[model samples]
Target: MAKRSFVWGLGRYLILATAGLLAFVAVVLVALRFVNPPTSAFMVAHQLSADDARVRQNWVALEDISRWMPRAVVASEDQRFLAHWGVDVNAIQAALDEYRSGGGLRGASTITQQTAKNLFLWDGRSLFRKSLEALLAVAIDASWSKQRIMEVYLNIAEFGRGIYGVEAASQAFFGISASQLSPQQAARLAAVLPSPKKMSAADPTPYLWQRVRWIQQQMAPLDGF
Candidate 1:
C-alpha cells in the first residue's frame, strides 16, 4: 500500500511540475513579444565554452539595418517568409520526401523556427528540442509581426565564431556598419549563414561565391520589402 501510494504521489508531482513548466514557458513567450531578448542559449553556451573566446554582437533595429539584408536573408534562407505563419509545409514535405528517397537530409526550418530555436532552445537535432521549437515558433508567429520576426532573426543569428548579428558580422568581415552594408556584402553574409564557422564572408571560396551570386540574383525578385 505504501509503495502504491508513493507511486501515485510521484505521478501527481510530475504532472504538477510539467504544468508549471509549461505555464512558465508560455509567459516568457508572451513577454518576448514586447521585449528584445538580451542573449540566447547559443550565446550563453558559446561564452561559457573554454575553447571559444567571447564574440561580438550588437543589436541594431530593423530600421537601422540595411534594407538589402532582409531581402538577402529571405532569398537565402526562407523564400516564403512573408507567407508562412511559422512552419513551411511545402519545404517540410520536400525534405521528408528527400529523406525517404535516401537522399541526404535537407533542412526545412523556416526563419521563425530558427529564431525560436536560437532564442529559447539549445543546439541539437533531438525530437524534444524540435518539438519545443515548433511550439515556440507558433507562439512567436502568433504574437509578433513578420518585420519583428525578421528583425530578431537578423540580430540573433550567429554569423561566425564569436560573431553574431548583421552589425557585428559587417564589422568583423568588412569593417563596416550593418547600415552601410552593400547588396553584394549582404548577400555574402547571408551565404555564410549555413556554416558560418567554416565559411568566410570576408574571403569567400568558389562555392561560397557561387551561393553569394545566387542569393544576389534572388534579391531582385524578392524586392519590395
Candidate 2:
C-alpha cells in the first residue's frame, strides 16, 4: 500500500511539472512577441556560516545589479554582458576563431546563460552541459525580465568555493551590504570571482587593477547601448 501511494505521488508530481513547463514556454513565446528592453540585473543574498555546504550569495533588490555590479562584473567576465541578449555571439565566435583548430571552443555563455547554469545545473565543462546551458539561457531570457535575470545572476554567482551572491560577497569581503559597494570596491570584489581564495578586493593585484581599467573602457560603449 505504501509503495503504491509513493508511485501515485510521483506520478502526480510529474503531471504537475509538465503543466508548469508548458505554461512557462507559453509565457516565453508571448514575451518574445513583445520584447521590451531589459533594465538591471539584481539578486538578493543570504549570509551563512563558513562551514555550510550551500551557496552563500542572496538577492536583496532589483536595482543592485546595475548600480553595484555592472561595472565590476563587466570588468571581470564580459564587458559586453549588457550589449548582447542572453548570449555573447561575438565573444563566442572570437573564442572559436582563436581555438586551436578542431579543439577551438568559444565562450558563448552570456549573463543569462551563466545564471541558468549556476542556479540549476552541476559544474563542469562539456558540450552536453553547454547545450543544456544554452537551452536554460533561452528559457530564462524568455521567462524573466532583464532586471530579474540580473537579480538571479548576482545572487547565484559563486563568490567563493562555498560563498555566493552579492550579499555574501559584500559581507565576506567588505563587511557591508550589497547596497553599499562603491565602484572600486565592487571591482575588487568582482575580481575575486575567478579565484576567490587567491585574490581580494581589499588587496588587489596589478593584473586586477589593469582589468579594472579595461572594464572602465567598456562602460562607455555599453552605456551607449
Candidate 3:
C-alpha cells in the first residue's frame, strides 16, 4: 500500500510539473507579444566571414540592416518581401516544383521564414524542418515586421569563414566599413552568400564575378525604401 501511495504521489508531481512547464511557455509567448526578446545569436562562417562581425548581438530595426548591407539581397532573395506576411505562395509553389523535379536543393524561403529559421532554429533542410520553419515563420510574422525580419536575416546569415553580418562581411572582404561599401562591393558580398568560403570579396572567383554583376544590375531596380 505504501509503494502504491508513493507511485500516486509521483504521478501527481509529474502532472503538476508538466502543467507548470506549459504555463511557463504560455507566459513566454504572451510576453513576446508585448515585448521584444533580446536576441542572442550564433555567427555561422559565411555571415561572420570576417573577425569584426564575429560576435552576435540583438538586431533591432530596418535602418540598421539597410545601412550595413546592400539592398540587392532584397531583390535577389525575396522581391515580394514587402508584399508577403510570412510566406509567398507563388515562390513556395516554384520551389516545390523544382524539388519534385529534383532540379536543385531549394530556393523558396521567404524573408520572414529565413529570419525565423536562421535566427532561432537549426540549419537542417528537411520535411520536419520545413514544417517547423513554416510554423515559426507565422509566429515571426505575427511577432515582428518585414523590416525587423530583414534586419535579423542580414545580421545572422552565414556570409563567410567565421564572418557574420553586413558589418563583418564588408570589413572582412573589402577592409571598409559596411556603410562605406559601394554598390559593387555590396554586390560582391551578396554574390558569395551562397558559398562564402569558396568565394572571396577580396578576390572573387570567376563565377562570383559574374554573379556580382548580376547582383549589381538587380540593385539598380530595387526600391529599398
Per-candidate TM vs. native? 0.93, 0.69, 0.73
lDDT of 3: 0.68
Q: For residues 77-174, what per-residue lDDT tens digits would candidate 3 score against the true structure?
A: 77788887788889989887988897885768887777767665666778898887787787677666566666667766657766667777766777
Please identify model 1 stretches exceeding 4 Å from their true place.
Answer: 1-7
Which residue runs does candidate 2 get wrong by more than 4 Å?
A: 1-55, 64-66, 100-106
lDDT of each: 0.91, 0.66, 0.68
Report the error of model 1 at residue 123, Å.
1.8
Candidate with maximal lDDT: 1
Give candidate 1's TM-score. Answer: 0.93
Which candidate achieves the best TM-score against the true structure?
A: 1
Q: Report residue 27 deviation for candidate 2 (angstroms).
A: 8.6
Q: Which ten residues in a row have the lowest lDDT in candidate 3?
A: 39-48
Per-residue lDDT tens digits of candidate 2, residues 1-225? 999999999999999998999688667545633452232121222223234445555556656543747656765676666667677788887788778566656465687888767665665788898887787777777667776777666766777656667888888878888888877767776777666657666667899788666665554445421
User: If ranked by TM-score, best first, what sequence of candidates would result?
Assistant: 1, 3, 2
